[model samples]
Target: MVLRAVAVSRTQEDGGRSELLRGTGVGPVGGLAASGLVLGMQCALLGVGAGTGLLALEGARPADALAYGAAVCGTCALLAAATMLLAQLTTDATGARGAGLAALGLLYAGHGVWAAERWSRAGAWSPFALRGAIDPGGADDWCPLLVAGAALLVLLAVAAAAARGRDLGVGLIRFGLRHRRPLRAGGPVTLALRLSRMQLLAWAVATAAVAGVLTAMGENMVELARRGAVEGGVLGSLLGGSDPGAGLLDYIGVLAGALACAQAVVLVGRFAAEERSELVEAERGTGSGSARLLSAWCLVSLLAAALTLGAAALVSGLVGAALLDTTAGDALRLVAGQWPSAAASAGVTALLGGLWPQARWLAWAPLLGRVA
Candidate 1:
């Protein structure tokens, strides 16, 4: 009887280990390495594409192109590493998912700052020129001071939102309910929604704030142009023929929105995978159905994209109008024009989440392909 019991116990232990492995998608080290390699290749291709395109547009030399490509690849690798580290640390799928979003938000903010710096420097107006027109010596001191102040303000606002979000364990803006009443029983869909909602909102707010700042800055370009600070007529034409600042802001906001939307799609795709794993199934077996579960996931994902983009657009429009002294109508028109492309990008991401179960990372393939 003792020997028979021992054999039965061994069988149960082996079965339990198998189930755990399947649930987490954790396999042997070889399998993990293989999966990582595949992801790296896809990301590298994207980096190459983006690098080459940027080089072509900027008319960079071969050396610059190589440098840019290397940088892109390195950045992608860093992002991947950060993501995996977050997954390991949280040991919770939802936390891993939120880390992906928070990383994207940081990326967007970084890009916005970079762009703003480049635009401000390359922009037509310098303190020297302003000094030449008015008081020469005074211009130098004030110009840098003004730009630095504005940049600092924007950065601080974004940082504050991020900090607040971390505290609340939600997105920058609160969404849905702050707290849920303890229920006698809840299912998978409810649980998924609860886990994801806060993270989604935090990401949206961070992305939107960056977009808004960039857009507002762009609206000031027309004033710069009117002052004849910008010599290049061609450049002015490209910048929307409005105030140089406003034009640049508009362009940056649109680009930022597109990028943020891509991040949102990638995020949602990952969420879907987490949902399919045994963790969600266990919750579902308790009460959840496919429709309810999927719907909640979809809603949270869509909300993240919409709120991020919408905040960006609205902020850009408001700031641009304020700076340019334009009517609300004009501002709305500019914002509206950029929406179609952004919406399409978001839709493509949603489709990928729903359609592809295995190789779900392929949803990012298109964005990666564009980089190549």
Candidate 2:
């Protein structure tokens, strides 16, 4: 949302690409710092709330809960800041989001490995070791907090230094194929797809990576289930079915569907942004009407959601078959079974885009409400 807001602001200014680069102080450096701080603080508060609430329910001492909350908040602060820096350093919105999400996944995975191995000597070095420090029934320790705080300072310094050398709109890494053919005329749908193709690809890759990881760990997950580790829990209720082998596959499908729905909402919001910025308007002035352009954007947003989600489903199916002893056909069928829910979420977003383009963000309310 922050990145989208930034992108929208950038589009509001009347300037060439190079001019925006020259506005780096306000555009990249300042925005990065401010957004990072805000997101970091929010994450910290959220972690604190969740951690304290759960600990309180478990009859832990208030002092201990507060201490754990502090540790979680500190770790979250560093993570949020680091992710924001990574996002700012990326060239496009999609890359920014993807990199940040991947970094988050890596941090958690690293912490999981560090904990599961029962290795304490290297705990301080893991990016998310703070989580382990706040373990229930453990000694109250501040070492992880100290380490995270110090690391955050160093990371902030490095991120600021890195920002100094980068052009405002360019990323550290850039790759694209030059067009060899003459441009052809197209409707707003074509234009919207072109603009969003990179983001869609990034979303697909992230989804596939997550699904692949889950699929590869299917055996362990099944074993855990069989041992009654997750039996009758939320996981068991959501993923468990007649065939234990298919439980993990079903879980993946549901998760992928939710992600696809969120992506659809984001895509629609992007369409609204472009329309409000007059990018779509300019195209409409060229032998098109507002209604026609809007219809095109709606179609394009739907298509983008479908294509990206389809890619995720396909990859998940193939990966599950290869790594989890599941048939590719079954995996595909599982993903297919969940498509209508995603389509419903996208439909709500599209309705908002058509009726209240400037207020399409309200479309998020449904998803949040559903989750709550």
Candidate with best TM-score:
2
Instruction: Estimate every model's Cα lDDT from 0 to 1.
Output: 0.50, 0.64
TM-score of 2: 0.78
User: Least lDDT summed over 10 consecutive residues: which range in candidate 2?
Assistant: 6-15
Model 1 lDDT at residue 117: 65
- List model 1 lDDT by residue over 272-319, tens digit each: 554544445665676766556555555555555666666666666676
How far residue 367's Cα lies from its native spot in candidate 1, in Å, is 5.6
lDDT of 2 by residue, 272-327 (tens): 65654467667767887766766665676567556656776777788776666677
Name the 10 consecutive residues with the lowest summed lDDT in model 1.
1-10
Q: Global CA lDDT of candidate 1, please?
A: 0.50
What TM-score number comes out for model 1? Answer: 0.56
Clashes of each: 21, 0
RMSD of each: 13.4, 4.5
